[model samples]
Target: MTIEPLLKYMSNYIDLTSDEVVFLESKITVRKYLKGQYIVQQGDICKFSCFVLSGCTKTFYMDGEGQEHILMFSIEDWWTSDMGSFITQTPADFNIQCLENSELVMFSYDIIEDLYREIPKLERFFRQIIEKAFVASQKRIVRNFSLSAKDQYLYFRDQYPLIEQRIPQYMIASYLGITKEFLSKIKSQLILEQ
Candidate 1:
């Protein structure tokens, strides 16, 4: 099993002994999802927190009108899950889907709690991760309210330049909370300025 990516991620927060690494490897289940596959669907209980080893995934919600609003994107080395659902063991409000064929390391909530008990450092590591995620989410909310559409597009472009080539423009537009046509106009203006 290829667990190098997960191990590398954990190393940032805590130093794991070989035995701990082995224990982690035994607990995690590696899975692959094809592009367009749904890892967690709206209204279904989210059972696992997943780390993306490769490829991309998007967490999004569909409105009653059937429009998608992307909440977050996860690429290699990133973690993605419906946190509330995973923690509370309730149905998810959003869907997590793969944008490309993806490899993921998944830990069930029970296993994760057990790990936290067995290795307290892992709890701190996850707590730090959640803290960062919360901060980022807050920043995004602020940006959506305060930033201009062009500024939002530019911010996203600067932060995730490679994402444009990986996913469709409409998805990017949705993520930016702008119309696809408006995003195209922004892109055109940017090109003209360049």
Candidate 2:
């Protein structure tokens, strides 16, 4: 399926002409992954930057005690990748896994680099994407620090209502920095109050 969201995302930053869209479409490859599969594993040099078409994926890393602490989640219309690795051509510290069956439009780093070199407009697009991503990441960190577990859960649920339906409960808990049992308790408490 064509990624209409990609066009929309590009449009938000820079207007793409019909000819530019056609050229961009030619460089993008649609990829699919099954649930529990990794889109990119830790230590592999990232080759592509992916835009999620459907489903949920997480970026996380195992900590000293081997807990999988989440960095971010990508749902429909969001992009997923270890962008640092993708750009630097180095081993990724984060593992990106599909939480459910997912479709993505992937742009090869090399090809896109070529595109940016030849068509400078693509650089502006990427720069804008990265700038926004940095801001969002900063906000997430601030929220995680300030919000209580229940508040965080509530906020995340409201922010990505579709994400809850698409991803497993345990993964959601992991993303929220809580145990599955804690999440269950929170849900039960919420129900009781309601």
Please report the TM-score between candidate 1 and the true structure.
0.98
Model 2 regions more than 4 Å off: none
Leading candidate by lDDT: 1
Tens-place lDDT per residue, model 2, 33-98, is 999999888889888899888888899998779889788889888989999999899999899999
Q: Cα deviation in Å at residue 36, candidate 1?
A: 1.0
The alpha-carbon RMSD values of the candidates against the true structure, listed in the order shown, are 0.7, 1.7
After best superposition, candidate 1 residue 15: deviation in angstroms?
A: 0.4
Clashes of each: 0, 0
- The superposed Cα distance between candidate 1 and the true structure at residue 159, in angstroms, equals 0.7
Q: Across residues 33-142, which tens digit of lDDT does each residue of candidate 1 receive?
A: 99999999999999999999999999999999999999989999999999999999999999999999999999999999989988889999999999999999999999
